[model samples]
Target: MLIVAIILSLIFGSLGFIVTINNAKYLLSGYNTMSEADRAKMDIAGYLRFFKRFHIFLSVTLLAGVLLLYLFNHNWASSYMVLYPLLAYAYLLAKGNTFYRGTSGQKSGTYIGIAILLVVIIAVGSGMFTSLKNSEIVVTESQLEIRGAYGIKIPKADLTNVSVVKQLPAISIKTNGFAAGDYAKGSFRTTEGRKVKLFVNKEAPPFLLLNTREDEIYYSSDEVSSNDLYKKIKKWQKE
Candidate 1:
């Protein structure tokens, strides 16, 4: 049930993004006086373009974020997943439809008012209510094992090792830009030699504390990153 809910939430989020994106374009076209078909295409193409640029990161983060939510609590992920679509919907409304404004030189989408109204209704109807619930995150001193996707752990020993290695990060530095993304850039790999980007570390080794990519990265075609692996570290220090 939980898995199914996660997948469905993803689908809903994707579709919701599409709907709101198109709606925005349509509305903007109305304000800008774009043709019906041109407006429709812009409505979609804009989101598509934006998604393509960030899709690489968004898909990984959202999926991992939701799945990891399962570790904290059963519906924790599901509850947040529900907001994905709502968020996308609200984005278009907020981004506005057109660049042109009224004669007063105040440029705003003519239909934004309507979109905001709908967002308010849909956001509430879609279960936007979440009782502020406080929960503690249990982690180990050496390594905390999260019982979810990769079930990764951050061992105190490894953190110490990384710290120790940090004194001589040159050992972890590679010659080329293979580690280009820096701390900000995280990665996941697949059995088929395919690689995906990620933000969370789910593949750190106990003794490998510094944020160096595993001598050999953790690979899996499925949807998983080592959860605790940090490929992020100082460059020249490693150099």
Candidate 2:
């Protein structure tokens, strides 16, 4: 997952720089909105230089963060990696309005609003990611416990069926939760018209199906071997 994230960051970051270099006019659409005298006084070249430097800084910081994750897997470093770029980009956006549009700092309320919105978004997004990433399932003799966001604990006595399957049926509806790429960690409805809870990392193979008195749950883990998990659960159920 870290490798995939790093590769995607490198690809997108490089593409942003390429587009900025090749298509400056596309981003400076507001140039025409300026007064004639303001437009004449605009240092178009200087604006482009500022953007180039900003892009480079952003790209390098991301790459560095990726490398740090690859090497150490530090949580603080990971958070810093995400936080710093957003803060830097926010600063750039505020500064750009003044530099490119001749807007005074006091008049850049839109920029300030956007920066605040971005900060809120980053905080919420980071919190969600952390919650999902920390999700885990624990099977005990009396109960199966799911830990993390959208979690629940089911008593073994209430479960009617517990088994492992090679694949899951199609999902009909996501009653709640988030699904991105290969990660599906939340509540969903199966194609068979059953409500299911999912805490899965990869959707493809090796899943556990739990049928309780009221609901069916589907889950898998990236950190543990599926066969080992199945054996553990079966043993716990017998106890």
Candidate 3:
């Protein structure tokens, strides 16, 4: 069950991020409304619709994948994590003032898109909370360690280690694949005790994937000096 959960989480998370990047690229490549084309010549709706299509479809697929992930694991609650991805995607599509009041098209596409994005976000966020409401938690002391691409190249010794409650606030799913969340480039101790989480925030979208990078990271769930561990990763990256 644990392995399945991990795999499904990773797969769904990866899919969500992938669709987001592609959508971003496809949307930004062609149009910038600021350029004033002749009013009669311009097809505002048509131009904007191209970008909107990619995001709309991507959001739908991402949400569907998230749902399947939860159903497969019977974790109907963790499903709310889907909102993170949804918000990221929605904001991307709706953030700009794509709608104008003078036009009859004012509330047609853009309004509905924004509305859908918002509604789904609220629905899923509610689910994430209820899912974890009734679960058992175990805590115990452990050790700290760091790892890398090739293998466990670092020991727990170079950096500062802070131990907080094992509870990590649900990170936005859109930021899940990118370094948009708390652990974008850092490490987190996944265990319930003595775990330390590192925060990294230097990633670009469409390329550097957070969850994928996460798999190659190290966790320090126990109390330990991180001197040796940090050095190992530094040296390894250099090599």
Structural similarity to truth (TM-score) of each candidate? 0.32, 0.57, 0.27
Candidate topping lDDT: 2
| Top TM-score hit | 2
- Tens-place lDDT per residue, model 1, 79-120, is 555555455545544554442222322324435555676767
- TM-score of candidate 1 relative to the true fold: 0.32
Give the alpha-carbon lDDT of every model.
0.39, 0.68, 0.38
Backbone clashes under 3 angstroms, per model: 25, 0, 18
* lDDT by residue (tens digit), candidate 3, 1-239: 23433464556445534433325334442233323332234344553554455445554555555556655643342343445556766665554434332343543555687788798788656644433222111112222232321112223232222222223433333222222112232333344432222332112111111122224332332223234334543444344
Query: Which lDDT tens digits does candidate 2 get at residues 71-184?
Result: 664444445554666676667666666554554643365466666869786886677566546458887767889888788999989878878888876988888976554557
- Candidate 1 yields a Cα-based lDDT of 0.39
Candidate 3 weakest lDDT stretch, 10 residues: 201-210
**Candidates sorted by lDDT, best first:** 2, 1, 3
Model 3 lDDT at residue 94: 57
lDDT score at residue 79, model 2, on the 0-100 scale: 54
- Model 1 worst lDDT window (10 residues): 176-185
